[model samples]
Target: MTMLDRRALLTKAAWAALAAPAALGGCASPAPLRHDPFRLGVASGDPLPDGMVLWTRLMGAPAAGADAAPLPGAEPIAVRWEVAEDAHFRRIAQRGVATALPELAHSVHVEVRGLAPGRWYHYRFLLGDAVSPPARTRTAPAPHELPGHLRLVHASCQRWEHGHYAAWRHVCAERPDLVVFLGDYVYEYPSPPDATGLARTHTLPLARTLADWRERYALHKSDPLLQAAHACAPWLVTWDDHEVQNDYAGTHGRGEPGDFLQLRAAAWQAFYEHMPLRAGTLAASGFGQLQLYRRQPWGRLAHLHVLDTRQWRDLQACRAPDGPARAVRPSACPELLQPGRTLLGTPQERWLREGLALDANSQPVRFSVLAQQTLFAPRHYPSGVQSTDSWDGYPAARTRLLQDIADIAPRNTVLLGGDIHQNYVCNVETQVAGRTRVVASEFCGTSVTSRSGTTQDKVDAIRRLNPHVLLARCEERGYCVSDVTPQRWTATLRAVRDPLDATSDAWDLARFVVEDGRPGPQPA
Candidate 1:
């Protein structure tokens, strides 16, 4: 069939399934195929009020080489997907047939619409007679209505070789309404020989080409626990440095200097191909240009402003671009405070400001949620040093953003950040002249499996330096869950006892809350 005809068929099949649920019977009990075509598992993400994106890749094997290929030939593969009102898929809501083109790695991203809002859905994929595992997903509340409550998990930095994905298992157990993943979904580097013992290694070496990046993503997606989290809740994700390269800003890497645009193009393409992001975000040719920064609303309860920090940020300041730039004092790195330096870039910064304005004017947006990578709260090390990678590096830009936030002053502003691999609950204050006005609350979640950079003593030291910091933890690894109500928002930092142990159980490290009118976090 022609491409246009195939798309039409896919849409027709999906709507037909939705219109006549009874006609799409036996979805729960499809005859088994000769071979499993979904070894990488299935996922759903970016749920809207009426639709969500369902994802799956047809794979023949698990390895990176030819023996592990999913499809048999270069021809397009026909795949069928179904969404149901029940886990058993007895009440089908939507079903579609998609052509998994060989050029796009035999992956299918079906944007299924025409469903009820604030409801649960079970989805599965079919390849010929082969049936993929059924996964659960949910649609967001309708935009015009006000949601009474929302539960969401904020997670980031799941390095493959660090340890087991026990944190993901815990996240899936929570089964929150949604998941906001703030970057570092995959590391571009391979395991180093001198590194701490690895729980697993990358399927291939460092990802410099499209093939390498695809292999790495496939390897990570192969994890059953990770897949479970993706299947459980529709995720809104934005990548940090590791999604392409370590400490990369725009087209530049730390100090390994070259025109990295080509390599970046490959990484971008691979990321788009694997992610459950919508088709409109896909690039037409060359490197993919995805507008990763956008606002996702949970009715009027919250406006989750997901940011892309690494994509447009200016390079690190006060040192060589190739080497590790140690934390420096203000006097040593005055260039870091340059007015022109920006983390979100000018366009995105404007987009965010305008987006917040539009959201508040249109609805009763209770919370202006900043869900992005890296900390917005300033960290002051006891040695009179500050990180050059976080908001601290772009002091002027941070000031501008904070000042604007203070000026517009949303009812309840909270920043959800990750990338430091440490948990920090701080009060975001804007200082004008000599007066400090507490404008927002910041809850920075820890990593999933990555190691923390500081000890308890170090955490204490940093907290001492930055009095706005209410709580800090640096030794453990896990994610955070937040419960949002119209009256108050509470967050619980859940840390796994040991990331190396697959059976490790997580416990609540601490809990913080932001009251309806109060902008800063208070101990709960």
Candidate 2:
């Protein structure tokens, strides 16, 4: 029989078997093979009213070395995918075939389009007799339509060796319409010699080469709970430092070693292969250049401005030439106030300035959402010391962005972020025209499983100094869920009982709310 005949036959069989309601991670598991190529599972990201990108990678094994990718000179594999209007997949909304290339380690990115807006659909992939786990994805509400509500879960910093992914387990249960993941998705470090309190360990050394980065992503994605979160909803993802190296500013790394740009290219390639990023232009930077900063809308209610802080950022202030950033006293570091020092670079800053306002064919956006990595609010540490790693390092840059957001978007703005590994709900303020005012609400969320070095004493000191901070809680691992409506926006802080246990239960740490016109969160 021809290849098309085999695929046609398999399609019917796969759909027949996947018609069962329980499909996420519970499909075709009993079948045996040399190794599960769909080990990284499937994901959908950056949803629009029409569609989103569906991603999956074929891997022989996640271990470092030969099994990390397909054997030498392997031909691309033809994979079939289907999207159904119902959970049982009785009515097919969309179906197509995509080639999983060997050059990209047999990964597939299907940008399924032309779907109805503001609705959920079930999707699955079929390879030969093997059927991938069925997952769900939702399209954004149509631009002209004013949706009554929007629910999104913000998460980040799930370092592999630190703890369990129980936080993601709870995220799956939340049934959000979207998940905004802000960086540190994988740690670039090697497995520590001391297992000590580590709940997991990488089988490989530090990620440098393309193979190394690919294996690292596979290891992180190997966790079923993490896969479940991806399956639960479409995600809006942006990277932070650890995806390449710790505290890396643009192409430069800390006083460490090796060619940083090459390292960045490999890491970028692996990240693109693993993530459900929209397929488009390849930048001149080594691998395909991924344009991370863009605006996404949730109907007429909100406009999400997702920023890429690392790729285009100037090397953090007061660092040695070509070195990474460090916390320095403003008195010692004269370069800290350089007006040219930028976090989003100049081009991105211009794009953000333009993207913050109304788009070409979109309606008046009620909520202007800033989704980026790290805290947007000012942090004042005692003794005149400030971390050059956050927004505090670039006060002028921060003021520029904040002033534009305030001048254009005003009280309708909301900032969502991660990377601090702590929960901080603050009334973000900025100086514009000689007057400082709270113009946007900021919810800098905690890490998924990564541990925070911040202590309660430090939290207390920050609260004392920054009166705009409403809630500050560190030394815990969790995620945040926000519900946005025409009247108010509410956020529930979900924390896990034991991050070390796979089956650990998660509870609400706290809740905060912001009225439609108010630019700050209050205890609900």
Candidate 3:
């Protein structure tokens, strides 16, 4: 060949090499492993109609780490992964290899596509001699296709020291289409070494460094119950304060004395390392930022808008930036009423407002869901105080969001959230022409296993103060399973009999339904 022709051929070869480990139906060379490397178990998340991300981490001996972070200077390994139509792998739909790099803590995220829509599929990871667990995941329906039904279990705040993972055990039995994690996947605080009567101990130092954060995620992911829930379905995840530090507002962290930005970067990178998040999300968020907000369309039945309330919000008002989380009277903190204060920063706010206007069909969705992190209503407390860590602290922002829903999706919006350790079913109202109106329904599911410190009297006082609240209960710890149909949306507030019990079962504490074209939730 001529020199010019040779140079052109070399350029094409370089491009192909850059796109290495070709996708489905392509070729890959997988490797052999000495022992099983699935101790942390398998997980899948962020499913699309044609594809989703499948994840697993290569690990050393359990004694070394959970899917231990790779040793210094470890080389990247080619790990093979497969997507099948059946659990037994008889019908292999797609198979490919992904590199587990030391820089990413040896974790592999394989984006598998070209699968059928609205169908269940089984997936696993392979390292030649050893095989990982077979996990189940499903994709969403086609954009214009109206789904027959969709069931999702939303949960949050499971602290290791607070209780056992009985809530997740119950979730596995529910067999839902999707699992929505509204944040606090792992707590940053360590359990008191001298404390007794604890269900479990974090057994590590307070997570502040990169290694510390990795170790923290390892400890949490090792739980069989948590693993089972993950293996059950694809999850939609976002972070709350506990994932990094308590009550961290944007770059401000509990008013602590340290390089907070450096600490946040480590915690967030570790979060990316462990979560089955899209790799593009990390880069898109830019340095020192991690994007966690997106929209998930459930056919024409519902539009799920997952939001991030911690990463870009204004600093907490009134309290010392390093102060504890508490309910402060509005009069004491005038900044709470500032119009510019935000919980879901402006960019996210605009994105959410636009999505609620119309779906792909150019029609209002049957159910417009704000699958977010905190209570959205005006929740007044006993002494005219509201939580500084929740939406109650950003009144103007809350008003704007509520008004946006009123003007856009209006009667079909459902607000699903968590953060406060209580079960609440309430109405989100709007002021229309000097009259009070209920525009959207709200259900705040209590924690998966976190403890609630509020007393019955205090809860009673809160109920008396806010008449719009239909139900408020705080004794039990569990999650909410939302079943959506074209006619109505139903939420079952299920509570674990005992979060500390390994074999505990959950019972439906209460059920509420919002009929289509109606704006409020009623006992079902």
Best TM-score among the predictions, by candidate number:
3
Per-residue alpha-carbon lDDT of model 2 for 188-290, expressed as tens digits?
Answer: 9998999999997766888888989987887788789999999999998889999898888876784344577778878987887788876552343325256
lDDT of 1 by residue, 24-135 (tens): 3322222456567888788788888988888787776444353245455676556778889998889988877765655567777778889999898999987767788998
- For candidate 2, give the lDDT of residue 424: 92
Q: lDDT values of the candidates?
A: 0.81, 0.81, 0.82
Lowest summed lDDT across 10 adjacent residues in model 2 is found at 13-22
Worst 10 residues of 3 by lDDT: 11-20
- On residues 6-36, what C-alpha lDDT tens digit does candidate 3 reach at each position? 3453343222212135442332334455556
Error of 3 at 375 (Å): 0.9
Collision count of model 2 = 1
The whole-model C-alpha lDDT of candidate 2 against the native structure comes to: 0.81
lDDT preference between candidates 2 and 3, better one: 3
Q: Which stretches of candidate 3 lie over 4 Å from their true place?
A: 1-34, 64-73, 255-258, 284-287
- How well does candidate 3 match the true structure in TM-score terms? 0.92
lDDT of 2 at 306: 93
After superposition on all CA atoms, how large is the RMSD of candidate 2? 6.9
